[model samples]
Target chain A: AQTVTQSQPEMSVQEAETVTLSCTYDTSESDYYLFWYKQPPSRQMILVIRQEAYKQQNATENRFSVNFQKAAKSFSLKISDSQLGDAAMYFCAYGSGAGSYQLTFGKGTKLSVIP
Target chain B: SQTIHQWPATLVQPVGSPLSLECTVEGTSNPNLYWYRQAAGRGLQLLFYSVGIGQISSEVPQNLSASRPQDRQFILSSKKLLLSDSGFYLCAWSSQPNQPQHFGDGTRLSIL
Candidate 1:
């Protein structure tokens, strides 16, 4: 079974600053997908960004970018120009590229944005 | 565009009462559906998944049961509610097995 690990339980960043949340996974499959999901106080799960294992270049969405190091099995999310609305619980998930519907998730990291 | 909908954003039920939560997807066909539970201060626990109609797969043995009556309709039920079952239940769908899942707003179940 694949497992996702988010070492940081909690992270804080000042407004307009940059903060990175760390994530690592244990997977034997070479082809897989890594995702970052944000859950706000409303308890809605929102997709932040995603990275494909076969792709060497990282993925970015506006202020959100990922540092996907395939060799090290590390996929981290970097939030630049952080805003207060970014405060939420961030989760790291792993899924196989093959026909698997399961998404292994980490406990999650609580992010607090300071003004 | 495809969208997922889960009913009763919040629900409160008495102990031992029967429970049913409905979820439906629009503008999609034969999509993969899933049911997950998020307990207070914990990560998401996948309860059930279905690849097609009447093809439910249980990930954990619990008081919950899921059914896919139609291609885009998934339902989660329990014979009798348990206090331990109280949590945030979410319904999600993906066009394909490897695609990113789109989640509903989620139903907050409170068993008294």
Candidate 2:
């Protein structure tokens, strides 16, 4: 079974600053996908960024980026120029492959952006 | 663009009552649909998933059941609701198994 782990229960960052959320996973498959999802007070699950196991350049989406280290099974999310809107419960998720429909998610990390 | 819809934004039902939450997708065909439950301050718990019409897969053993009567419609149901079933029910869809899933606003179900 594939499992994702987010160690940071809570994180705080000042507006215009940067913050990083830690995430790790246990997967035997080499070809898989990793994702970072944000759930605000509205409770809407929004996709922040994604990374493919076969890609080594990492993935960046505007102010959000991922440091994906496949060998170490670590996929951390970095939020730059953090804004108040970035405050939310961030989750790390793992998917097996192109044919697997199961998405295993981590417990989650609550991010608080101080204005 | 594809969109997912889950309705009755908020629902309050009595214990032992029947439950039927509807979810539908538009602008996409043969998409993978999923049902998830989110408890307070907790992560998402995948309840069920479907690959196609009439193909439903259960991820957890619970009182809830799911059905895929149409390629774009998925339903979650329970013959008798339990208090523990009270949570935020979310419906999601993805173009493929490894793609990013788009989530619906969700249905806040409260069992009294």
Candidate 3:
């Protein structure tokens, strides 16, 4: 079974600063996908970014990027120029590209952007 | 242009009462559907997923069950709700395997 681990339960950063959320996963498969989702107080789950394990270039979406180290099994999300809107419960999820369509998620890390 | 809709943004039910939550997707066909339960601060726990109509997969053993009568409609139901079932229920869909899933606003289910 694949399991994702988010070591930091809570993180805080000042507006206009940068923050990184740590994530690691245990999986035997080499080809897979990793995702970061943000859930605000509205309780709406929004996709932040995604990375394919086979790609070493990493994935960047505006202010959000991921440091995907396949060998280390670590996929961390970095938010630059953080805004108040970035405050939310961020989750790291893993998915196998083998047609399972099942996403294993980490516990989550609550991020607070201090204005 | 795909969109997912989850009805009854918020629901409150008494313990032992029957429960129903509906999720439907539009602008796509044969898309994978999933149901997840999010506790207070915990991550989303996948409860059910379907690859096609009438095909459902259960991820956890609980009183809750899921059904997929239509190609794009996924329903979560329970004969008797438990207080433990109180949480935010979310419905999501993906175009293909390992694809990033698009989520609905979600339904907050409170079982008293």
Candidate 4:
């Protein structure tokens, strides 16, 4: 079984600043995928960024990027030039290559953007 | 241009009442479907997933049950509702096992 952990429960960042949310996971599978999802008050889950375990290079999507350390089992999300719209509950998820399409998610980190 | 739809947007039901939530995908075929429950201020909990029609996998033992009647239609049901079952129900789909999942708007379920 794979378990994801988000140590930071709450995080705040001033507008136009940068913020990093930490995430770690315990998984025995070598081939897997890591994802960051954002949920706003609308309750819609949106994919922020994703990183494959085999890829040594981190994944970046515009202002959102991931610092994936496979050896350390750590995958952290970094949001640059943060805006008020970035305020939401962020979740870290884990999935494997050969198995069910089910994803195990961390408790989540609530991000607050201050103007 | 694949898209997922789930409904009703909001639902309120009494305890012991039967429950059913429907999810459908468009512009895709033979996609993997999933059902997840998100408690308030918490992460998503995977309830069920299906790789194909009539192939449902349960991630957690709970009061919920899922069915895939068609290639693009997935349904979550319960014999009776419970207060613990109250949460936001999300439907997701992916083209492959390791691909990133696309999510629906989610259904807000309130069990009284």
Off by over 4 Å in 2: none
Alpha carbon deviation, residue B52, candidate 4 (Å)? 1.1
RMSD of 3: 0.9
Cα RMSD to the true fold for all candidates = 0.9, 0.9, 0.9, 1.1
For each candidate, what's the DockQ?
0.77, 0.86, 0.89, 0.83
lDDT scores of the candidates, listed in order? 0.94, 0.94, 0.94, 0.94
Better DockQ candidate (2, 3)? 3
Model 4 spans > 4 angstroms off:
none
Clashing pairs in 1: none
lDDT of 1 at A91: 97
lDDT of 4 by residue, A1-115 (tens): 8899999999999999999999999988899999999998888899999998888999999999999999899999999999999999999999986765778899999999999
Candidate 1: list runs displaced more than 4 Å.
none
lDDT of 3 by residue, A20-107 (tens): 9999999999889999999888888899999988899989999999998999999999999999999999999999978677899999
lDDT for each residue of candidate 4 in B52-111, tens digit (9 for 90 to 100): 999999989988899999999999999999899999999999998879999999999998
Per-candidate TM vs. native? 0.98, 0.98, 0.98, 0.97
Q: Candidate 2: what lDDT? A: 0.94
Ranking by DockQ: 3, 2, 4, 1
Native contact fraction, candidates in order: 0.58, 0.80, 0.91, 0.91
